[model samples]
Target chain A: MTSALSAEGLHTYYGKSHILHGVSLEVAEGRITALLGRNGAGKTTTLRSLMGLTQAREGKITIFGEDTTRWPTFRIAAHGVGYVPEGRRIFANLSVEENLKVPLERGGPWTIERIYKLFPRLAERKQNRGRQLSGGEQEMLSIARALLLNPRLLILDEPSQGLAPLIVREVFRIVQQMKAEGISVLLVEQNARMSLEIADDAYVLDDGAVVYSGTARELAADDARVRALAGASAEEWTLT
Target chain B: MMTQLLLFNVTNGLIIGAFYVLMALGLSLILNLSNVINFAHGGFLVIGGYIAYTITPYIGFWGALLLAPPLTAIIGLAVERVLIRPLYGRDPLYSLLLTFGLAFMIEDGTRFIWGPQGKPVTIPAFLAQPLSNDLFFITGYRLFMVVVVMIAVALLFLLLRYTRLGVRIRAGTLDLETVAALGINVGMLRSLNFAVGIFLAGLSGVLAAGQLGLEPTMGTGLLMPSFIAIIVGGIGSLPGTLIGGLLIGVASGVTAVFFPAASEAVIYVMMAVILLTRPRGLFGEEGMMS
Candidate 1:
């Protein structure tokens, strides 16, 4: 299958510190690709580089055959790449409706009504400002806003971070729905077990490099090896 | 006698109050959209008054009124593109300092061009007549200013509340980053907003020339009072700025009538008292550093 998004030898920096050292990965079209890593594993940095939020020192990042390594964030977004940064950075002063409207793409299937149907809570609190919404509502709004762009590839940076279990489940459900609709996703998740369960392909990023890559089922079956590579406690695997 | 004096004070108050509202509204719009205090706002006003003065002799009063604001707006656009645009995402204090320096330059530039002597601009012959009754008398020029400002304020309020561009501006003011993400060119929107703000300041300055003498330093006098209005009204709220302006205008008018010696100091005193009681001013947001 043709890769919808591909990065080869990507090098990114924050100020003088080199955070992503020669990272490389590929996201197949119409599949849920999970990038699993522990804290400081460069998962967020990879997403940022892909979205052009941070400048990549050396690398070729292609989105649907177009090189976008040096493009600005706004231009990158215009090329059908939607980004949800790690923290739910919803505009605090804008109403839920306004927040959704602010990033409304000119022509797309993800209208306000469609997003409302997908996340009922957002519709219910459409008039409420960002500060008034609960954590789960904010996350849902963030995803809903990105989805409204009808992006060819959705890059979510730790969407489950701080979300309640029920909300996290809902987020995973949305990911499955996206996969079914043939939209590619690059999900960065710290929760290895849940992410592996939903993801079609899994990549283990450690020390700013892709240490392991395989089918999600293969990664799931090798419990001992996956745990050792992921550095997750035995309790975390058992919980799943 | 006291009742008669009170009536006079109230009339004077309304006139001055309306003028403050006009000036403060312009300042608030720029502050909300650009997130800059624009210390050079007063300079725009000074330039605007000069524009009117320069053209009034040739184009007549109505033509001068129309010509002054757009000219000032173009100058404002130049200021934003040349100076303000380069300093975005940096500390707000830097912009403040830069604009402060610009204000000094503008004031001095006007002095060099127009000279230090203040020039009194006479009201046009058509508006110089006074409408008087036994109890109350109003100058036609002052009344015309009040009416014109009221119309402008109403139009501004309508534009901000309605219209597609206005909607985008309102959204941008609340959160600029999100607006940009939506594919709206935030830089362009900011430039347009800066131009509109300068236009308003220039409009106010032209109207003010009819009331007071035109001098390079006239804008300097208006700056502190306009700022006080903004602080008291709330930094970003339009209606709040209006109220703040009117409040200062009336208080100053009344002080001038009753306590002539302390009239100049009254606004500062009132500001101090308001700060002591409600640091955010009457309508200001809680915890807003400005």
Candidate 2:
């Protein structure tokens, strides 16, 4: 499979502290690639670097075969990359419908109507402000907002953070649906088991380095490796 | 007779309040989106007034009113692109200090050019007339000032409500990074927003010149009220700024009726009371500016 996004030796920092150290990975076209690790394992930093929110000091990034290492966050996004950052980052003052309207409308199959259909709860609370939404509803809205961009590649960081197990299943369903729609996905998650289940390929990041990159089935079967590298407990890596 | 006097003062207060609204809205826009305190906003107002004053003899008052604001906005755009663009993402203190120094430069530059004497902008002869003998305090110019302010304000609200650019600006004010992640160029958005704010300031200068006349230091006197208006209204809210401006204007005006010396002090008192009680101002959100 051809790679949709490929990074070579990315090194990122915040002020004086280094966060990502010479990390490299690739997401194949029309497939889900999960990057799993414990908190502060540089998963978010890798996504941020690829999106150009945090510039990697020493690396090259190519998105859809175009060099995008130095591109601004907006330019990278305009090139068809959708990012749902950690913490939901919803505009608290905007209503659910207005939040849906925030993304620049790229021509695609996704529309506000389609988004509302996907998240019926959002449709029910269309007039409610973002801050009023429950954690699950906010996650749905955040994902829905990114979908409005019609990105060829979707990058999500910690979509399951603070969400219930049922909601986590719903989010994973959406990620699987995106892959089925021929969109490549780079999913960064601390919830390794659910992501690994849906993901076709998986990379385990440990302290800013990729310790494992192989088939998701292989990673899922290797319980010892998953527990050691991804920091998922025995209960977490096992089938629910 | 006493009631009429109070009415007259109240009207004067409202007209002044209208001026505050225009200036404060622009300040609020830049502050909300760009996080720049813009101490030189008053300086931009002075530049607008002087530009109008200089051009009125050639193009007439209507022509100056039409031309000066766009010209000032162009200057504002250049300033944003060259000077202020680099300062974003840094500490807010840096922009504050830069704009503070810029305000002095603007004042000095105007003094150097216009020679430190008061200059009045001529209004259309029709606008200079009183509406009637009974309400002589409501001169056609003052009424025109209020009307112009109303139109500008209405247009501003429409732009924010209906336009794509306006929605982006409001979203950017709340969460710019997300807006950028959605493929909107936030830097360009900020630049356009800064120009819009400056445009309002420039327009206020043109209108204020016709009413208060022009001097180098005229902007300085008005600057504090605009800040107070933002604080009184709410820091991040445009509607809050609007009501805050009008509230202070009318408060000072009503105070002038009973205690002339206390009129100027009333706005400060109101600000103090609001800060003590609401802290976020009348319409400000909880935990804002904390």
Candidate 3:
């Protein structure tokens, strides 16, 4: 399958600290790819670099056969890469509907009605300000806002970072729906079990380098290796 | 006797209150949208007053009123492009300092050009007539100023509430990065907001020139009162600014009548009291547009 987004030898920095050390990954067209890593393992940095939120010191980021490594975040977004940043940076003063309205490009497949249908709770809380929403609601709003851009590739950084188990399940359900809709997704997740369960392919990142890249089934079958890399607990290993 | 004093104060209050609202509204718009506390706003007012004084002799007061705002808008746009744009993403205090310096520069520049002595500007003869036979007689020129200011306030309210550009501006003020990420050119929106804000400042200056003495230092006197109005009104809320202006205007007018020595102190005293009570001022949201 043709890759929707490919990053080659990406290097990134914050101030003077180097965060992404020549990391490389590919997100295939119409598939969910999970990038799993521990805290401080450069997962969010990778997503941010792709979105041009953090300038890449050295790399080539090709989106749909166009080199977009030097482009600004706005230009990169216009090229059909939607990013749901970590911590759900929703505009607090704006109502949920208004927050969603901010990212509505001139023409896109996703409309307000469609996003509402995708997450009914969001529709119910549409008139509420972003600050008034629960963490789960804010996450839903973030996802809904990004999807409204009708991007060819969706990049989510830690969507379940602070969510409860039920909300995490809901997020996974939405990811499944996105995958079914034929849109590519790059998921940066610490919840390896849930990510591996839903993802078509998985890349295991450690110390800002891709340690493993293969089908999710293959990664899951190597229980010893997965445990070694992830330090998975007994409960996590038994998760079906 | 008390009733007469109250009536006089109320009329005077409304006139001054309207002027404060016009000036503070312009400052609030620029503050909210661009995150710039423009000390140079007073400079724009000086420019407007100068432009009106220069042109009123040839084209008359109406033409001066029509031409001054656009000229100030051009000056505003130039300032934004040259000084303000480079300071974006840096500390906001830097921009404040830069604008303060600009204010000083503008004040001295005006003095050098217009001379230190105040210049007199006449109210057009048509508006010099008295309106009523009673002691509450209103000059046509003051009435004209009132009407023009009200019309401007109404138009601004409608523009912010109903127009597409208003929607974009409000959205940008709330969350600039989100607006830009959505493909809206935030830079252009900011520039437009700056221009509109300075235009309003110029309009207020023109109105003031007709009533008050026109001089290089005239803007300096109005600056403190306008700032007080902004603080009393919420920083970004237009209606809040208007109410704040009215409250300060009336308070000062009443103080002048009852305790003439403390007239100027009334606004500061009110500001101090409000700051103690609400900290965010009336109608101001906590941590808004920060």
Model number with the top lDDT: 2
Displacement of the residue A220 alpha carbon in candidate 1, Å? 3.1
DockQ of structure 2: 0.58
Docking class of 3: acceptable
Q: What value of lDDT does candidate 1 attain over all alpha carbons?
A: 0.81
Better of 1 and 2 by DockQ: 2
For residue B271, what is the lDDT in candidate 1? 87
Q: Per-residue CA lDDT of candidate 2, range A63-170, in tens? A: 999999999999999999999999989888777887887788889999999998889999999989889999999999999999999999999999988887787888
Q: Each model's C-alpha lDDT?
A: 0.81, 0.90, 0.83
Worst 10 residues of 2 chain A by lDDT: A230-239
Candidate 3 lDDT for residue A240: 39
Output the TM-score of candidate 3: 0.88
- When 1 and 3 are scored with TM-score, the better candidate is 3
Question: lDDT tens digits, residues A1-240, model 1?
Answer: 999999999999888888888988999998989998778889988988887767789999999999989977767777877778788788676678767766646587778898899888988998888889998899988888787777888888888778777778888888889888888999998778888888999898888888888898898898876676557522242223
* Docking verdict class for candidate 1: acceptable
Give the runs in model 1 whose Cα sits over 4 Å from its true position.
A225-240, B54-60, B63-67, B111-127, B134-137, B154-175, B286-290
Candidate 3 chain A: 10-residue stretch with minimal lDDT = A231-240
* lDDT tens readout by residue for model 3, B1-290: 78778777877888899888888888888888888888888889989988889998998889999998899889989999989999877888999999999999988998999988888887778787877756544678888989999999898877765565666677777767766665566778889988988998899889888888688877777778988998998776677788899899999989989898998898999999999998878878632332
